[model samples]
Target: MARGSDRKRPDFYSRKAKASGRAARSVYKLEEMDQRWRILAKGQRVLDLGCSPGSWLQYAAEKIGPQGQAIGYDLKPVNATLPAHAEARIGDVYELDIEALGTFDVILSDMAPNTTGDRKTDAWRSAGLAENAMLIAQQSLKPGGHFIAKILEGGDVPELIKKLRQNYHKATQTRPKATRKESTEIFLVGLGKRH
Candidate 1:
């Protein structure tokens, strides 16, 4: 068997982003999804939750083009180097005032609560964030819009998936090729918002 140092670690996202001159590796995740689902369109209004490094914001801004708008929110201040069309806010998602920002055509969330090493606790925390993102999407997304969020593999995921299916015309899970194989995290894409 190869030693840990000798084994090649996969980082497809970083490699691709570096080749394309993007700020963060996470951009590839959005790119792949957009290519497959065509969830984004020019001039659409987008909201990005937990958008720290602002990779998703960058991807959305480019896809939405000049006429579109992208807003990002995170618990901490985002770096000042984001694209001109993208805006960032430092705030908690649960306390966010969606009405203040107005409705959006797409709501994307990459929120993952801090891991505590305890599997049960981590799962619960992650599920809470997923649920919160869903709530925000329900209030902010326009009819036939899109909602995307990060969720852990265990705990209440089944229930959450059911709930998402109820509110969206189609709900699917995705493990982007950019994500590490060892990670249990997966993204849930809810398309064609029902409410």
Candidate 2:
């Protein structure tokens, strides 16, 4: 039998990431997605959800560069300092006033629900978070923009996909290589937002 602590052990990505100065290993996920699908571009505006450790924001700032804007919001204070063009704020997604942040060319969400270890309950909660992210994207995403949000593979994802299909030119699910083999998480990529 496998020890519970063993499951918590960091893998290769974590080790390399620790040495690479990334605040979180999740930077690889966004990097891979952007490389594969061109999700980010220089001079575009981006908003990141649940960006506490700020690794995603770090990578985003690099890709967006000085000409672009990267705005991150989370319930806790961001752990890393952002670039001049990037800003991190303490805020809750459910209560966030997105109008103040303005519209963006892209929105990325890696929000994870507080898991209880019950797969069904965890899936439900994750689905709820994805739903809220979609609503936020609708409110803040520019026409013909893009959205990428992490979500559990099961639960109410079909409904979410259906909703995205109606609003976006393309909706697809992708899992980056950086994701753990056992992880049920996947990214829902919504391309060409049609407001």
Candidate 3:
């Protein structure tokens, strides 16, 4: 028998993603969210948080059509092939000035923390990242804008949902089919921000 470390992990999603020319399987999660929420439309400016790999950027640019624009910021380098209308930068979300970047019609975040296998610690950390993203949304989202983000479900998720509901007309959680069966990650979509 192959040793545990020597055994190759089954990678259906990554293989399928590569075959479809997507940079990552995470693209399908964003696709499901967009399809359900209509977050991307012509002429809508979109912001992507932690947008490394740039698959979300590419998908957003296509959905926004030629008239719209997609902007992404990440702590690491973004290396995916993005459309002409999409732009990306290497920067931290906490430091980026939303006023300088201009308000966006929609914001999407797919950020994940570096896991250490401690479930509780990771969940709280994920919640913190989501909260930080919310802070950015308050500054960067135009009136009636939408916000979507991925978060590990646990710890302060209820509090996070409460905060989102207080800020937007509609707030809900969704787990996309593309997500692995064992994953605790889920998405929160906040629609129609109130001024």
> In terms of lDDT, which candidate is strongest?
2
lDDT at residue 68 of model 1 (Cα atoms): 90
Off by over 4 Å in 3: 1-12
TM-score of 3: 0.91
- As a whole number from 0 to 100, the lDDT of residue 18 in candidate 1 is 68
Tens-place lDDT digits, model 1, residues 1-195:
011211235466667666876766667777888898999999999999988767788889988987999999988777737667789898999898778989999999888776777768777888898899999888889989998888778858788889889999999889888766666778899999997
Candidate 3 structure quality by residue, lDDT tens digits, 64-163: 9879999998887778888788998989777877788888999998888777688898888778888888988988898899999888888587888899
- In model 3, what is the error at residue 31, expressed in angstroms? 0.7
Q: Which candidate, 1 or 2, would have the higher lDDT against the true structure?
A: 2
**Estimated TM-score per prediction?**
0.90, 0.93, 0.91
Off by over 4 Å in 2: 1-7
How many residue pairs collide in each prediction?
Answer: 0, 0, 0
User: Would you list the rank order by lDDT, best first?
Assistant: 2, 3, 1
Which window of ten consecutive residues has the lowest lDDT sum in model 1? Answer: 1-10
lDDT of all predictions:
0.81, 0.85, 0.82
* Candidate of highest TM-score: 2
